[model samples]
Target: MSKKLIDSGNNAAAMAVQLAEAEVIAAYPITPQTPLTEKLSEVIAAGKMDAEYVAVESEHSALAVCIGAASAGSRAFTATSSNGLLYMSEQLHWAAGSRLPLVMCVVNRGIGAPWSVWNDHQDAMSQRDAGWIQIFAKDHQEIVDMTLKAFRLAELVHIPVMVNYDGYYLSHTYMPFELPEAKAVQEFLPPYDYAHTLDPEKPESLNTVTLPYARLDINGVKRPGYMDIRHNLHQEMRLAMEVWEEIDADYAQRFGRGGAPILDPYCCDDADFVVVAMGSIANQFHVVVDRLREEEGLKVGVLALQIYRPFPTAKIAEALQNAKGVMVYEKGLSYGNQGALYADLKSALYPYPNRPQLHNFIVGLGGRDIPTEDLFQTLKTACLNGDRNSPEQADTPQWIGLQL
Candidate 1:
């Protein structure tokens, strides 16, 4: 049985972690991610959750604790935001490269030299190449459901998974969502059964220095080189997309929540124009799509990307093939070039002969408000300028909600 409850996104994630029965939680508070770890600590203290809560000294140490726990065959979790996530950068790579199946919640926020404790996707997007599976949640329910799914996906692929959602937008906002029963979550996710672990009885070195070429072990068994190990990680990451799709289907069958795994399309089947985004911003586009459809008689839809990494190139390309135009709105960009998602979408559609015209919009950095009117106008302009504008004009990324 599932119970409907109204709660903040952070609490939603905490509830999922409780249901997932994480054995070890290593956390250091960083807003808006602080409340999540706090809630977890509270549950453990109240005897509602059976887990070891380690309050670490810093964000780096937080992930370090999780790494140690996960390495020892324990289901471990951690949460952080903005600089905290950046501080754990090295451990992020170590967790993935070591093939530790751990899960983390990254409440997305802007990175700072200017120093603002606000919301953006920069924190997670900056770590796009960190070899971890990153999944974004658009609402409270997704926060709950995806957190549960993250543990399962991580264990299956033997890669760490980051469940990301907008910092204050989703993290602090309260919304109603169904909290799945502990029994149901237990049935969905099995106990962690890692094949390799740091057992003193069976001593072995892990992630030690590797030579450029394959080497023979003391027992004369052939072992992979640095490049070979990296290549295998890449292959497994790619394969994880299919694995996620299958897991999503099974989850939907049992829980009736997650059918669309990679790309969640809202009325895109017959849309002439599609707006693409991730996290809470994508949820906002639903209203924009409806207004354009009903008020302006335009066939526009919204496509929210659930999985940012593993790219899902083929599926994305196929989904947007029929549309005449696609407008990608992002909260983060790849500084020198363009919005990361925009660049990726162009690459995905490059092989198609009749690819749609693409446009990129950067919005809502440092907790800036992204009003619905702004999205509505920007999209309307893109629709009006479709295919007629010069290549340079269309290709250049535009900044929305910019005052200067």
Candidate 2:
């Protein structure tokens, strides 16, 4: 049985990490993410979780520590946000390329320039191609569920997994969540049995320098080069998409709770227009979807992207098959182009016949509050305009909730 508790998203995530029985947790403090690591420290000190909690000087060292632990055959974990994540950028690629089954919680926050410690996806989105499998949580329940599942998923694919949740929106906000039993979680996620690990007796070179061209090992056998190694990472990600679905299904069978782990659809079966969003904004869109459908009888729905890394192209195209228009709401934007997600979604649907009219809105940067009514109104206007066959009337990549 699970116990219900009202706690912040950080607590829920930290609890999940403990339940997953991570052996080593090395993290550096950052806004909205600090609480999570702090809680982990408390758990370790209190003897509730038996793990080595390392206090690192920086986020880079934090992930470096996790990589070292994982390489030594341990279930390693870490968490960070915004600039902290960027500071660990080099190690991020290292952990993924080295094929370490390390699980991390990235509390998504806006990036700096004119600095702000607020919420947005610029942090996580910026690291999209860093070779790690990225999964976003819609609410607190998912914060716990996905974190536990991340450990399982990462170990299965021998790839790193970053579990992302909105910073203040989800990380700092408190909600009632069910805490799963530790015994059950342990049963669900078995011991981390890595195929390869740094062993003294059974010695083998790991992460040795490989040139771009193919090379031969000491035994004169063909060995994969750098490019080949990178290609293998891509292949693992594609295979991970299938693995993620299976894991979610198995988890649902055990816990009686699970949804589409990638691209969750709400009232999208026969809808004419569908809103595409990620993270907490996806949860907000659910309210707007309900209001439009009930009050105005608008055939509008929402597609919340849960897994962004593998880029569920086929699932997205299938979900939007009957829709006449697709609108994407992004908390981050790509300079000189559209939003990252907007561009990706456009590409995903591009190959389909009679693709729906698409639009993108950049919203809620630096902790700016978005009015619910205004959001609904803007979407309704866009849908109405698209209905009039005026999809190309204005230049796209529009900015919403901006004060002139």
Candidate 3:
């Protein structure tokens, strides 16, 4: 039934997983991500869900349990935050290497030394190379919708997928969202087909013993070789770009309203200047773009990145084909650099003859609010000069909502 209800992003994620009908769930919950798995546990206790709830001691075992569940042909999921992600980091790659279509939620949060419970992208970005098909959610609706889609995509491609959303911003924030009809989710994603299930009657070995660096020849002569498992995983990650988009196109046609993009565009066709961003910051920057356009009559656009991992370079370059300049807004810094997204965008558009000037603007670090006027001012300043490398620069992330 199409219906409206308010939900915190974490709760919505748990609800999505239940509706998706995963067979097993395992996790060592951390803050922000904790309430998500906690709700799942409650659902399990109340007989609402018939999945196995494996309460492991550490994040390592949580993911280990997921791999084990998936190996036995059970659709599985888990959720974690910050250090928990890094703690399960090794298992993340293992899950992918074993070709388990495990879907996990990473409530985006700041990583700590002094310790923090706030929101940031450091955790997810730190685990970026772990071979998970990463998708970022801007709002609670995407959180719910994308979590369900993550499972289907992971199963189709035989790779692990992580749906990342900001901790306090999305996880705790309430917003109106409609739960998709069961028929819609069912049609969108059928049941899991296990070609390698570990059934007692038809027993098969799981991510079993492999000699560290050994290969057997046809003549039974053993040769040495490292685990090239990562190579295969890399290829599958690349394939996600095609499979996910094709599936999303179908999904939008059937169930989505306007539908979100791997890179959602806002006025980019003929705009000379564009502001590119990802996650929560993108939503704020979007409002800023509208004001700049309406109030100042400037030709500007906003390109919000929904898919962060496969980086979506080709699409970005093509979309910004007419863009003369770009201001990149990022919540997390690249450390020793202005912005990570800035560096990546610059690299992606490197070969273009008429590419953008690409000015890097870092803002909203550690739960800071990014205002429209700050973006308006930054865009105005970037417009005044074409030199992105000028020594007397206009802004230092332009410090939105800050004291001079």
Candidate 4:
């Protein structure tokens, strides 16, 4: 039987990692993310989890260690946040390019320079092109479930997977969840069987530098060059979409809960207006949608995106096709432009004949709390102001609750 427990999102994530039976864990201390790795370390010290925990000095080294472990055919785990994620940028690309089936948790936080240890999507959004499959969780339960499924999906495609949850939002929020048994999790997620790995008996070179042009080796075998390597990576990522769906379906069968691998639509059908967002913020919109529908009799709905890296263009467009307007709420801005979520969503709806009145409201930056009243009021204003005829009105992102 599944156990009911009250715990923070970070604790849930660590417990999920434990249940997944990770062979190795290497992480650096960074706020928001620090609690996650710290919990894992405590479990390791207590001899509860059978894993090699590496105390790394830096985020780059932490991921580098995970890369090495994954290459050696070990299922590895790690966690990081904010600038720590940026510091591991070089290794992030390396892990994805090498096709290491590693799973890492990103506690979403605002990037530094202004130096704020707060919540935002800027950190993960900046690394969207890094070739890793990124999935954002809306709540504590999804965070645990997604982290477990991440390992399965990553191993299936031999591509690294990032299970992202909002910093201080889901990461710090305490909630009740029915925890899955370790035995059941093991059954759902079989031992990771890497197709190709470092073996001592049969030595093989991996990730060797290649010239720009394709080349024929000494054995007269045609080898793909640099361009081919990158092209294959892109193709593999495209394949991950299908694999992700399969994994989510299987997980639902075992756990009695289905995770929204691509997009989570809330009361979208028969609704004229839809609010689109990601992470924990999207979860809040669900409640708002319910209240608006109940109290004001508005046809407002929510389409929360779970997968960000793949962009889920078709799924998102299909979900919003009937809506008269779309309000994109984001915690991160593109700096001098609009929010990244708004930009991608706009491009997705461009080819459609009857596109909605799209509006982007940038909000909740640097850990700003968005109360229910603020959300309802802001969205009410959006619904009133959004005009499909006045396209220029929705062209740029509008800052919400900005003191300026």
TM-score of each: 0.99, 0.97, 0.91, 0.97
What lDDT is reached at residue 235 by model 3?
73
Give the lDDT of residue 19 in candidate 1.
95
Error of 3 at 396 (Å): 8.9
Q: Ranking by TM-score, best first?
A: 1, 2, 4, 3
lDDT of 4 by residue, 174-209 (tens): 998878998999898898777678998867788887
Query: Cα deviation of 7 in candidate 2 (Å)?
Result: 0.6
Q: Scored by CA lDDT, what does every candidate get?
A: 0.93, 0.91, 0.82, 0.89
Residue 280 in model 2: lDDT: 87
Clashes in predicted model 3: 0
Q: Give lDDT: candidate 3, residue 66.
A: 91
* Candidate with the larger TM-score of 2 and 3: 2
Considering only N, C-alpha and C atoms within 3 Å, which residue pairs clash in candidate 4?
none
Model 1 scores worst on lDDT over the 10 consecutive residues at 380-389
TM-score of structure candidate 2: 0.97
RMSD (Cα, Å) of candidate 1? 0.9
Give the winner by lDDT: 2 or 3: 2
Q: For model 1, how does the per-residue alpha-carbon lDDT over 1-404 read when each residue is reduced to its tens digit?
A: 89999999999999999999999999998888999999999999999999999999998999899998988889999999999999999999998899999999999999998987899999999999999999999999999999999999999999899999999899999999999989989999999998888899988788899988999999999999999999999999999999998889889988999988899999899999999999999999999999988888889999999999989988999999899999999999999899999999999999877589999999998989999999999998898776788999899999998888
Q: RMSD, each candidate, Å?
A: 0.9, 1.3, 2.9, 1.4
lDDT of 3 by residue, 255-284 (tens): 765355588878777788988887767777
Pairs of colliding residues, candidate 1: none
RMSD of candidate 2 to true structure, Å: 1.3
* Cα lDDT over the full model 3: 0.82
Better of 2 and 4 by lDDT: 2
